[model samples]
Target: MSVRKQQLLKQHRRNKRIALLAIIMGLLLLGFIAPLWLLPLAVLLVWVVHEAWFADHLFYSPQDDYQYRFPDGVQPLSLRLVNGRLQLQESSLAQQATVIAKVQINSSWLGRWFDPSICIGNDQQTFERGAHGVRYLNLTGQVEALTTAGLAVQGRFCSIATQIQLYVFTQPSPTAGNMMILAPHADDAELAAFGLYSGANNVSIVTLTQGEVEAEYYQRLGLSQQHAAQLKGRLRAWDSMAIPLWGGVAQTHCVQLGYYCMQLPKMAKQPDVPFASQQSAEADIRTARRHNTIQLPGDATGLPTWQNLLADLAACLMHFKPDVLVMPHPEIDPHADHIATT
Candidate 1:
């Protein structure tokens, strides 16, 4: 046997032993520590080793034939795994494996000794917010089969059905705080309806953080012929790498709420004093109109600053129906406007 093959064999055996030990120790530790915390890592290690063994075997033999299959309307994915880079592209819509793609990898010294990533685009959902789509993974034996076949894959493979709704607005606008829109935090009924809590495959909204999205990338997050053309060239798309455990997905409409929310003036010190006498109040309404602001009504109400601000806020909230409303407490800092708005 070649020296390289001999070395690979030894490494494979060692990995197997380590994986076995992890499983055994993890199970034993479950008695003392929370299984929820330790078991996932343990399982991940087992998967890594099992995949590594197969990958080495495949790497050692290039002549072994392989076949990739997919269901109808289901597209095969092209993944390139070179070093630590993972590139995934959607195959032709024909629903068959006609191309072999690789994922990119970045392997460091420590990674080589520990766990090295094989695939890069697993958790990627939509390319942009409000664009309804997801990269679906079929949890059949094929992925594991591929991993064992000497292809590098990271993490556990579970099958999930994916669908996405891309909501795009042709006219682009800036959002307040650069926060990505999120679905309203799920209520108990929503959780049940979406099967989120029950672990069923229902459509649950997820909101990526601000960093995950680039608003300038698309004219509107909604579907566009220009974007459609772009999709035509690419094989696959992935959501940017998000901190797997820290971020979540939610749906959001693109607009600035604070644009209107901030316009509300603080209540006057005397509740009975009408806002008509306040120069800031009159200027605020005019400024809002010139800016094409959606909140201010032209009908003049001779109410106090506080009353007028509250009425304006109520209207803005009703129109926006913000899933998460962000309001700054001016009272804490005591800005003249803040004091009045509060």
Candidate 2:
């Protein structure tokens, strides 16, 4: 920014703050004070005034930035997204550049109200500063790679970071080879990568859990929580194994590990501790195992512990010896299990 622009922005903010204080003073002079019993309503009235003044500049729904396009050279960023920095050039950024990306960062409701000043070179813009489903980032005359844009999503840690692609990139075609697809739940394999490896040869689908925690999905069947959960697992497990047949995977190639849903990270964290299923209340995976086509590899623990899952997954890998492996991107997938699957 030029010295003139910087001065103007500073003056602008100072004016807003002064104006806000003036409003408060004016209200007080106007005898706007309320009785003690109306304290809650008084606070609400003050908040209304503040929001009305900030409605145009401070608040924005990030989801509104759904569609974005970039000029013809940017490709799929080849560099690692270590933190939020899009490390394009090895040097510091030049003062002038362009908005090369339309990014959608997952943030909390509170975070949405406050802009995350994304830094690209010396240019730092916020999600509220751009339009059309993308956060504009500055990237041009590279002066340094030391600069960065970081996201501190409120309410929770970072979740899915979906963004529109502005860069140009090529993808290779899938070929015949030993390939394995690991689904954290029943349909994840299909939703996350059906088109990715459906045409590939020698594909194996490995479902880690029966998704027993989704028992609420079967509540209409007039069954108890445990029965409904167990039933959902059985049905979804079959969907996980059988649906891929249409995609050309051999029926025998699909297998289920028969663990509970939403409990994977816990199982991994407490590998030795036996965590019972919240839905089934059963301390074992025997029910889910009944739907498996492939046997547990090696002397599998068959217990609901993290070590057994790791051992089972390792054995499956050895059995397939896949040339290519497919799993969720821990940084991108929203589900915790999907993140743990990787």
Candidate 3:
């Protein structure tokens, strides 16, 4: 017998012995109880005894070992139970790009209704039960990132194994063409389009908003007034640094439209809403009076109107005449500003 089967057999025998003892003890106690109540009490006692004895078996059972191998040149990924925990093992893909792992898990009979918590990659990812006790989770990060990155199921009633697959795509080479990246916020381009932005030859990043709404975030961190004033400058500096990081000799253009953050979706939807300045909410009331703003293209004013915003964006497109245009997905992206910009 396999090691897992041997363990299961030993556990089953132990539970059987405990259950038998509980039944005998229950019968002995029932002799002192009223004869009419004996049947109900006996049933309750037996259920409690059985549950205690077989609780561990509810999660684990002996099953045939399974192995999964990916196509040649692709990293092979495998799922297995090691010492009662579900784990994912993979052969290293000799690349420095990010890897996204897609995992799907299905529950057994009891777990279908009871459900359980499933963890992935050092508990970085967690999934609850879904309809029909099925759950899907996606984990994305740089290659060879985590030390204990794997899948784990946590529930006494859970008994199903996990399935996982990896996706890795090669980054395109830098070419001499105009590339425009439309970012809803200052950091959006850095987060979503860093890889693409770093590879493009002539790139123009248009930030729809100044991201001034992060004032609250800075306040929460107890930053001083001087530091807060320097926030926008720091962000602009970071944008300039991207050109050197990408090995691009040509200067990268950064266009900032100083629109209020957290209000883009509302303004985009209802164009008539009055514009609110993010500078009004400042840590030091004195510094809030000074407006150090970037110049917008097309001689655009700091207007919150959707028409002006569209016109400015149009002017940027016309000026750049980009061969490749990248913007956030409208419906799929969860951020309201991203959706509005898209």
Candidate 4:
């Protein structure tokens, strides 16, 4: 045998010996320190760690006779292992191209490793160890007539066989449209629809309540009055700032209905629930009466508070006229306000 082949064989033998020694030591340690009930888990963990460590350094020769052909009328594609790194090459007329490739690495003991990666051009991609074996990567880049890409996979493992399939496609342009997000609280819209808000041409957020009940609840929890006030103010401020930032435009409308927090559904079900503090409730009644926003059938004294809420929401819907409406799922959501809003 050649000197290089001899060296590789010797190194592989040494790696096997080291791996065996590590597993024995781990078993002994677990037997002494780990409880009987945890022995199985400890053994499994030790075996996994040993296998991963072994795979990280092992190298396998690629089958020289293996040949890969590109799809009919598509760009020519080629893959080869060079100095422990996988190199992918493709010929294209476009200046930039998106390459999507699926790579399968098979190990005798440890199941198949599905590491799919995308490469635009000469970009380098890294693979990290995953639960099953290793997670793949995606690459993006710009190239001339010919594109060359290299992937450096961590933890060199001998693959029984490696299969790679490549596909090329263009990315679609961004779409524009009107989007409406309804939130039971100030921050809910940002939390749920930030992606839509950022991408859509026009976005409107309707926050149903001021969430003052949160401040009251915090106070009831023994927080200082000043701290509670600060928390409430911060929540409102973040809600306002987050929408503008996510929407990428100041033209977005933020409609605040200023309803009592934590009481909408309760008031709808039982109008006598007393949604606000006595002082605030009396003040709100006076304001509603003056604005003529509160119109109830029969006596005003017997009206349900959620009727006004529904009316205000209807008015908002009529004005915004959104093509898409994003709201909380009624049955799936556990929050009373979210369910009520839905």
Per TM-score, the best of the predicted structures is 2
On a 0 to 1 TM-score scale, where does candidate 3 land against the true structure?
Answer: 0.44
Query: What would the TM-score be for candidate 1 when compared with the true structure?
Result: 0.21
Regions of candidate 4 where Cα sits further than 4 Å from its true position? 1-175, 216-238, 241-246, 249-252, 271-274, 277-304
Candidate 3 residue lDDT tens string, 1-342: 457768777877887888688777877777767595676777887788556544444223523222333345756244444544444344454444445444444445554334344554445433332212333344434344332443443433444444444555444343357888888776677688887777776887777765564455555557654456357534543453343345352333666555556667777777755456455342221121122233334243445666667777887787778888889987558688888888
Tens digits of per-residue lDDT for model 4, 150-176: 554433322412444445555432224
Name the 10 consecutive residues with the lowest summed lDDT in model 3.
283-292
Evaluated against the true structure, the overall lDDT of model 3 is 0.55
What lDDT score is found at residue 89 in candidate 1?
34
- Tens digits of per-residue lDDT for model 2, 259-304: 7888888977888876667787776666666656667742355577
> By the TM-score metric, which is better: model 1 or model 4?
4
lDDT of 1 by residue, 107-210 (tens): 34344334332232343211111111123223222333334333333522211112111111121112222222222111212322222212321112221111
Off by over 4 Å in 3: 1-177, 217-252, 272-274, 278-300
Prediction 1 global C-alpha lDDT:
0.33
Flag regions of model 2 displaced more than 4 Å.
1-176, 298-301
* TM-score of decoy 2: 0.54
Evaluated at residue 169, the lDDT of candidate 4 is: 53
Q: lDDT, candidate 3, residue 13? A: 86
Which one wins by lDDT: 2 or 4?
A: 2
Once fitted onto the true fold, the runs of candidate 1 whose alpha carbons sit more than 4 angstroms away are: 1-268, 275-284, 293-295, 298-304, 329-336, 339-342
